[model samples]
Target: MTGLMAGKRGLIMGLANDKSLAWGIAKALADQGAELAFSYQGDALRKRVAPLAEQLGSDFLIDCDVSDMAALDRTFDALKARWETIDFLVHAIGFSDKNELRGQFVDTSLDNFLLTMNISAYSFVAVTRRARAMMPEGGSILTLTYYGAEKVIPHYNVMGVAKAALETSVKYLAMDLGPENIRVNAISAGPIKTLAASGIGDFRYILKWNEYNSPLRRNVTIDDVGGSALYLLSDLASGVTGEIHHVDAGYNVVGMKAEDAPDI
Candidate 1:
């Protein structure tokens, strides 16, 4: 419906480009009348994120490295300067080295594992802790996750483990924040061809496999994810918290390949 998020304002993190899932969610939130702020990690990404934020009517862009605690504090401090409070937060950030994404999980190096968990998982906790202060009146927080967190996907490697940690953190954060009326949840989205997905080896095959095997028999799009995200971030899901809602074309429920589907 129109104006589902009328008068609401929030931040969107981990946006890379127009094809990003963050972009999709941002468009949906803006369409429903939510004022948005975007965060980018570097100058290169600022170049890409600026135009897209403009399209969504958001000129508030902050550059912060999620892995750095000091940078995160400054990011929120900047937000506090512009808006005293916010109604919601969209955290779609996650990352791991492409080199480790292709290999076996056992082979994952200690350095990469820590880096992956810090960015892919712990950043949400750090941001949420900061955002909680801005939500003195309580608010909703949404983060992106994946089926790989629950089930194994080849080449997903350490990032999968990090997602698992992220999903668990959602529950704990929800419990911790719920006392203050703040809601926390996540969207375990299906495979989509975004800049982030490019790091996963044999990602195309994974996409085709899901397209063939999922109950919907098709791959999900960013718009598909955005719609779900809108509901979670809006008041419609006020009763929901500590939930891992799947936006994966029902792929999580399927135990085997479809009988009618051809081999990918």
Candidate 2:
């Protein structure tokens, strides 16, 4: 019931602010007694991420862009300087051009498509390879995903395609690493009003719609996601791997709008 991660240490990548999903997961891990290191892309985010990391009793922050393989190498090298091995890894990173986020998927430009795939999907693959080297005795790896990958949502656009790729990567990585005791998984969270969500067109409507129609009759919070991440990352889920766990408040099961739901 307490200190589920009492002796664990890990790195959290892509925490933008207090409201970031990464913040929720990091806090959960820390509260359960995990030592955490954070990664930020630039000085601007360092200013924001540094203080938050302090709140969790962590001063270890690494600067690296996930899209850059050399930067990722340096990041793990820096991590190795402090801790030779890691118990887990939390990858809560993804991005797409706001301009492309709103338009029809058919209109997606090749350049943006590749860029989005590189950042939103391939980054997970890149980070996992590095993290695997640090988990010689076995470990858990988690990444954030969305329901948009499974079903078409207005304006989710190419990010959905990227998430689909990410979800599949989880399966393949799990198979590749399972023999070594490394587990790979993803959380397809429901919509939340995070900085990343603000880029999607008509996002407010998407939130409201999920609120009105979901079985829970409301949206999920970062804390809701945090609790689930805690379970997956902890020893509690030792038998689970290569799974796309849904933390969407039962919304993914709905067949249609609720009969009594108010129109969004």
Candidate 3:
């Protein structure tokens, strides 16, 4: 059980704490004997992420604010110098102004819209561009998404639009990198309480509503999302590319709430 990824190495982003979905996946991957490197957005998170990464036996921590080119380049350069061939890379970063996340989609400012797309959607492309160069044997790239990408999640607003584009990019990237054997995909996770999720309007109601109505009759956990991520990143999913795998406790598949479930 520990050997599925015994010699594989990868990098993961978006870990804010032990509760983060990225940390969950990192723990599982490390438990399965995969060596890991982690990136933090700034010095504060670096303080937090660095200790956990080391506890899992990783000295591969780098400071990478995805929006910065020099930082991104430095992060990958460190990995390239250390590991000549890598197996996977995970992109779990996303951002949108708190003000815009609560209001009508029409009210979203152009600045915030571009900012959200740049950090949330385009960062995947920006980092992958560098990460790809280091993966001479090809590798897996997985990003986190939400059902909001395909359908409107109230108050999700422009972030939803960014996710939709991110999903599309996954497919196009998969094809572009196929010749080199690198696979690209995204995990469309069910809602989980995170610092970012707290920005959305009516988030509390969304959580309760989803648990009572989804097919699994419960909300998803970080562990659930992490396991799905491990599968996509590992060789187990070699043939799975350009796909959006859902780990949302059957919530995304529902067309309507059950008759007994309360209305929104």
Best of the candidates, lDDT: 1
Summarize candidate 1's per-residue lDDT along 1-264 as a digit string, tens digits.
359999999999989998899999999999999999999998899999999999989899999999999999999999999999999999999999999989699999999999999999999999999999999989999999999999889999999999999999999999999999999999999999998999999999999999999999999999999999999999999999999999999999999889988977
TM-score of each: 0.98, 0.99, 0.97
Candidate 3 segments exceeding 4 Å error: none
Model 2 poorest ten-residue lDDT run:
1-10
Per residue, candidate 2 scores C-alpha lDDT tens digits across 37-129 of: 999988999999999999999999999899889999999999999999999999999889999889699999999899989999999999999
All candidates' lDDT scores? 0.95, 0.94, 0.88
The local lDDT score (0 to 100) that residue 159 gets in candidate 1 is: 94
Evaluated against the true structure, the overall lDDT of model 2 is 0.94
TM-score of candidate 1 on Cα atoms, chains taken together:
0.98
Clashing pairs in 2: none
Which residue pairs in model 1 clash with each other?
none
Candidate 3 C-alpha lDDT tens digits along 189-261: 8888988888888898889888988998989998898788888888999899999999888888899877778
Q: Candidate 2, TM-score vs. the true structure?
A: 0.99
